[model samples]
Target: MFRTPLAAALLFATPAAAQQLTPAEITRVDAIVADALASTQVPSASIAIVRDGRIVYARAYGDQGPGMKATSADAKYQIASISKQFTAAALLLLEDEGKLSLDDKVSKWVPDITGADRITVRQLLSHTAGIQDYWPQDYDFAAMEKPVTPQQILDRWAKKPLDFEPGTAWQYSNTGYVVAGMIIEKASGMKLLDYLQKKILKPLGMQAMDQDYAVGPGFPQGTHRFALGPVRPAKPAAHGWLWAAGELAMSAGDLAKWDIARIDRKILSPEDWAAQETEVKLADGSGTRYGLGVSLGQHDGTPMVEHGGEAVGFLSENVVLPEKRFAVVALVNADFGGAPGEITQGITEIFYPPMTTQPAQTIDQARDALARKLFDQLRSGTLDRALLTEDANYYFTPQASADYRDSLAPLGEPVRFAALGKPRLRGGFVNRNYEIVYQGKRLVAITYAEPGAAGKFEQFLVQPR
Candidate 1:
């Protein structure tokens, strides 16, 4: 039978002003990760938790390879997108040294690309440059097998038309970072990797960080598991064009050390750090929750600065609770099965328990019953117009509902429909996850609502599991 993981109040003592990880906290952290490994079938992972600028707990779980056991002392994995923070930091360091300015136009360094005159270094860092993403949402997986140089990548995509006007909208673009890396080489008169090694990694004593995949020593292999069984070897991917964008390998503890440096101001100055943390706003003053390479959000009512990374076979998450002086980093050698946010949030809740008013248990029956009714109506090509919000109504029209039903038709009718986990509040919106079983296959349904008598549904989605 399925069970809610955090069903009861598994609380820890309030974090002391001095902040130390208790033995009890360490056991809980181990159990949380062990459970995740078992459920996801990921062979191994590395976890590190830092508090008050020091690593209090760091460990490796499972076997690293065919016969070798994974150990925290030496294991390293590709950190994927988390490398963006380093790229952003390098640019800021250059700015501090008066080698380059954030406001400098893209044309100042690499002028062959599109919109070079309008895009700035700061815009590239924040992903508002409007340059077409080199690896977009519809990125091709076959392209991974081919090696690419940074300039080759730019030549392929940079001269294309802008997706939108610079600073008008935000779009995540690996191309922006690639171009930024080129600018770094031009301004510093050194290779990007060499500059990083001399100016940042060596100074911070990050001895394990490396970018060359071919000459680099072997570490851990990434795996993929499609079902509940043994995982298969995923192709060893090279960073290729993702050099300064998402190409770095290091241990979780080392990553934690580098992150804690940010909080302690060991590298960038106070003003530069502030600029890194502050969100960039659009032309209309609407906020974009991204600052430089970091994503800004709130967790447990506390401010969180974080970034997640994903390459072909590795997934990484590094999060910092600046106000709490806490940070957690997790690196998993699995394609996408690892739940980094859940892992990080599990650690966060140990220090700060849920304080939001959970929707009363009495209302669950009503909510699920309504969901079933809506589900049936949607499958039968009709919709309860009163049940949907204006936005939902506009998006989930009869035609759209029919298309959705057709999408699920291949699965046959659902054999079971049950709530997957406890309903919780996120950013003031109450959301729930449910499992729908059909002919031995499982699919997921997510629904969100507004929480009172005016608690109408704002969004709903269904997808194959």
Candidate 2:
């Protein structure tokens, strides 16, 4: 299931009219990847950047193994959980074809699953099905060495006691996705990979992406290193063990093609894309900051849609700036550290510098003070309605207030509370993020205020760090 990185120099394949990165910028990128490789002892990495729906940069760094040739641009790595997005897309595609409904109960397709009648396909895609995760460890365990069918996995994990009531909370569960994959096969009457190829991959021209189990031989190998020890070939999970959850592998460039398609909204309808990007709300209306398959958040004030992947001997990060029509894909052949994510951060900063914020004006300072006061009020299960907009008032329902109080009160008083980064301007509101540190835990508070001399809070959200 692994392949050695090929020998190749830095590769650049961009349209003539595409935005060009300066030589210095390219040097910075190279330094970033090289530093990550040296620091983490990761064998190699493949990176690709897309701007305006065209690949602006593609390069590889390090070697195939200890003293082997340099890594090539086209070398594929197991993308791991990044494959979840593909699974989600397959289900969406079925819905588009009127073959299945995301709202359909799991019992409709696979009734043998525990609580199938109570869980919906949409909940599975969003990781809110209350299904216990079958594989939660970062490193492979002995159980992973034994091959098991998806149905067997479900029988072992999905049939267990519910982690919580469905839709009450958000927990990352690979078990939910496995069940989803099974549903796809039942609804489409095709293998999971075949359905993906016919409906998603082939249409997007992502020829380089495929399930790791199906890749057969002649591919490069991925390595694992312990401490500062020598690199050794990593042992992958048995075939079918990672089905529908972390089974896919691909070159960074091919992954970038998928990102471009997302940027251009080429595959799914606009409504479907919106559903995929919207943060899921729990029963109490608290946000999970996770969409169907991707995590939703802001990167230095710009909206970002992204996901990270980890499999034995490989790590990957994929990021998309939908508003800016930009994307970055980083794949590494070593899984011990976060080289791919670090490389992604460095590369993203080169193109989108962090926003600068002036010192808070008088009104802004008042809002900051108010944010602190509101945090305390939330801990006490109380709020000052006169200081909030009508919508905000409605948002703080009795149940929501209690939920906030129960969750925040247990954390006790914060050791530190301060503004984070700079204020963001959007939709005529001044939004700011605040960092709160408890005895041993940290949380972030997102605040939105109406712009005026006497501004009122429009939205205030608290999320765990």
Can you give the TM-score per candidate against the true fold?
Answer: 0.74, 0.72
Q: Quote the lDDT for 289 in model 2.
A: 82
Q: Measured by TM-score, how close is model 1 to the native structure?
A: 0.74
Every model: Cα RMSD to truth: 10.0, 13.7
* CA lDDT, candidate 2, residue 50: 89
True lDDT of residue 81, candidate 2: 90
What is candidate 1's local distance difference test score? 0.72
Error of 2 at 442 (Å): 21
After superposing candidate 1 on the true structure, give the runs of residues whose Cα lies further than 4 Å from its correct spot.
Answer: 1-20, 67-70, 137-140, 211-217, 227-230, 357-465
Record all residue pairs in model 1 with backbone atoms less than 3 Å apart, i.e. clashing.
Answer: 81-309
> What C-alpha lDDT, on a 0 to 100 scale, does residue 168 get in candidate 2?
90
